[model samples]
Target: MDVAASPTSGPATPAGPDSAWMLREAEQFIELFYGEGNGQGGPAARMAEIRAEVAGTGTYTHTVDELAFGARVAWRNSNRCIGRLYWRSLWVRDRRDISDAAGIGTESVKHLVEAGGGGRIRPTITVFAPDRPDAPGPHIHNEQLIRYAGYPQPDGTVLGDPRNVGVTELALRRGWRGAGTRFDVLPLVIETARDGIELFELPPEAVLEVELSHPRYPWFAGLGLRWHAVPVISAMNLEIGGIRYPAAPFNGWYMGTEIGARNLGDTDRYDLLPVVAAKMALDTSSNATLWRDRALVELNVAVLHSFDRAGVKITDHHTESNRFITHLEREEEAGRTCPTDWSWIVPPVSGSATLVFHRYYDDADLRPNYLRRECPVEGGPDRT
Candidate 1:
């Protein structure tokens, strides 16, 4: 159920009335994704054209990366008939090579322009590039800054003193605690290689991490952000070719799962924890309408497995698996329904899985900070 998939299999052909309707819808999806063919033939014809283009050259390159982000983030800006306000951050880097493009581009990028009327636009994004050291090679060492601006035009033009746009001068600002934390905010990073995008590498001991959230789920406290907790539950050490690759933390601001209902509530600070480290927990607080009511939940539990002691190089790899279990009981409460209990075994490179519970908390308007609410039968925090 991964929402992002290459829509290129089977008879997605537009035939018959029903098939034609589906074909039209599918083509529209393709148009939004490629950002071409604004001139209609419906969506089907455009998709067929794109399919043919890739088949001809065996390369499917896009300026905006993926179709979803371009549609949701980029297209809306250009399709003004929607009458919605739009914003985007144009990031730059010092250098890039095409061969190392792994997870570059996203489904959340957009192109926007506003003219006439007293208009206010904010272009807030994180820009990262290799830090200069005499000469710059692909060391992967770079500097990033969170940029915010009040107004602007489409072809990367700006109005008034951009500083007056209210952007904090410090490149690395933290939020509430680190609202001003000074890291980059781009969703995914990419570089150009031979003819396509590739993943860049960090030069030896120089590691960098940043927290990025969906603009719609800004503050980080509410459940909107909590959904990312799934990665914590999904993390499993992988040993490939005698090398042990540690599970990379879930690094995005919004919850990164492909299953279940989409969380539509405003996010508070407590909900945004998964983007930083790899693990976090939530307090249902016995609210049936809130946590209990959702059709599904993504839990981030640490998995113990065996693999090579060395790490595996991550390329354009996205591994996914699903499990279905019925009965779960809350440990703290003798009578309450508990969460599901499942485990993933390690390969030879690693051994035994451990379940580490890291709870998510809200510290924004704290007269008294909220702690993890305990289950009925057991006490909180330090439960055995």
Candidate 2:
């Protein structure tokens, strides 16, 4: 999994921001909103109100419209994502009033259900309460809302997704237990200033997983591989106009290569290429055989075929690459600089074949973007 690493420390209690900086960020965002023809009133009036609010309370609140617009723009400002073509269609759930651990957990499950859309996945985000001047917002300890648990065996091998071993150990420490299966979904560990830390199990129905099988290889089903449908990122902080929402879990549908070329095929993760190669009876005696490449292509083919047969919304890297090009053209026509990270924009598999691989991109760090949540400890999470 190339997703952001899960938070391994205690609750994220970010310090308060300066009132002057908050006002400046608010002004910039307000101008962008009105300039883009999405604001209710003139930016001048909004700026005046925000200034007064900030002067009185050291922070200001965004209207529902501002929040929604900010979130969509944040997605647009995401340099690494290849699916920015439909940024305006993102469904924003304003749950800013609920800040408790229980409420956040329940809403997080609801987010999965609604965003999954019963296999027809929808791009969605559930915005939780933002960190206030006096209080920090809630934080989800998992990198994603749904992840497979990893159990370390005495023989020095992991039973499940190795990317999740840290959070899995943390969950065990909190008296949480899984069914001891390779694909068992880990519990959501949410932390709040008021409620402390609490564990919430995601209901079975909320998680929609697709059993993987190849289009032509009947033996592929015997391998017993499966993956969850939606990737709901939870650990990142959504910074909008200097207001940081640490618990906002957002999702976009998967690209087949994200699962096949990275999660399952990567050596540090599942490392299933050799298993797949052996099953195909490929010549693995020498590097000249190109066994790993052949197996990787087949595995990616299976991922796309399974998702399509199951009616789960997924895109192939080629199609997504073309769409990204379209998104770039549209952004250019609209006079907006579409900041992009070339390394991330290129597909993990067959990079040279994708259109994104040929282009250079501006890797500027944009504001109102998803920022990685900093680890509270000194050196960060132990990867051992």
Candidate 3:
């Protein structure tokens, strides 16, 4: 974070819950999204009211407009995000009232159906219950509403995403068994220490998964690899207006490498590089062989090709990188400093191939953003 430019410059970090920081963040967000006054004597008046309330014993309630604008700017301020080009278009569903497990479960299913938009996946977020001064909020224990089960065997190999092995084990312990496939939707575990836990098995109809297949290789489909249509990250907490929504799940469209390079290709996760390399008959005897790289390219090709064939909305790394530059230029024109993580802006695959790899950015962590919190589920840890 640039200290000289921040309203809360005295603090080295910006993660603390300070009323002044919250108000300043809110003012900047509202002014950028909805110009001053909006017929209400501008953000200045709104900030005055918020300031008095924060200083006093009472809590301030952000207007619906304020809430909507906060959600949008949260995306814009996400330093690790590359899809900020469409940050202004995020469809924010205010579900802060539904606190129960069953209700949130139903709403989550609806979220998938609506966000997926039948494969025309829309960038969306569903803000669930928020934390209060007296109490905590409802939370989603899974990283995403739709993710696969990880079954670890004694042979030291994982059948699915090893990163989710703990969650899968918990799900199985809770009687939510899987079919042992590479793509199985882990039950949506929603809970709070006060409200208790409830396991929700997402209806197969609600989850739209596309089968992976290369355009040139028909055998790819037989490998039985698939991915969900929508990636609704339900685990992270959304902090805005000095209030934290512990279960505000947000999502953007996926870049092919998220699946091909990290999820599927990472050695600790699916670890399919060796399998893919063997499938293409590439030599893996040494690092000089470049077998991993060669195999990953085709795997990414399969991912892109499959998503395109299935009519699912998936962005390629190159296109998304260009879009990030466009977002940066727009933010600059609006007199906004675009806080970004250089490593994240670069694509997982072909880092040097994107224009974003050639630039440095202000690395300030901003407000109304998401955070990964640690809270234990009723039966397990909230690893997600």
The worst-scoring run of ten residues by lDDT in candidate 3 lies at 1-10
Per model, state how many residue pairs clash: 70, 0, 1
> Candidate 1, which segments miss by more than 4 Å at Cα?
1-28, 31-45, 63-68, 71-97, 101-384
Clashing pairs in 3: 37-42
- Candidate 3 residue-wise lDDT, 301-382, digit = tens: 9999999999998878899889889989999998878988786678778899889999888878677666655535322212
lDDT of 1 by residue, 1-384 (tens): 111110111121121223334334434445544453344455465566656644464322322333223322321221111111121231211112212323222111211111000112222221112112122111111111111112333774333213212222221122211122212121122323232322232221122222223222233323322111111100111111111111111111111222122221112112222332222233444555344223122222110000011121111111211111111111123332222112111111111221111222111211001112212111111100
Using Cα atoms with residue i matched to residue i, what is each candidate's TM-score against the true structure?
Answer: 0.21, 0.94, 0.88
Best by lDDT: 2
Better of 2 and 3 by lDDT: 2
Q: Which candidate gets the maximum TM-score versus the true structure?
A: 2
* Candidate 3 local lDDT, residue 52: 86
The TM-score-based order of candidates, best leading, equals: 2, 3, 1
lDDT of predicted model 2: 0.83
What C-alpha lDDT, on a 0 to 100 scale, does residue 292 get in candidate 1? 27
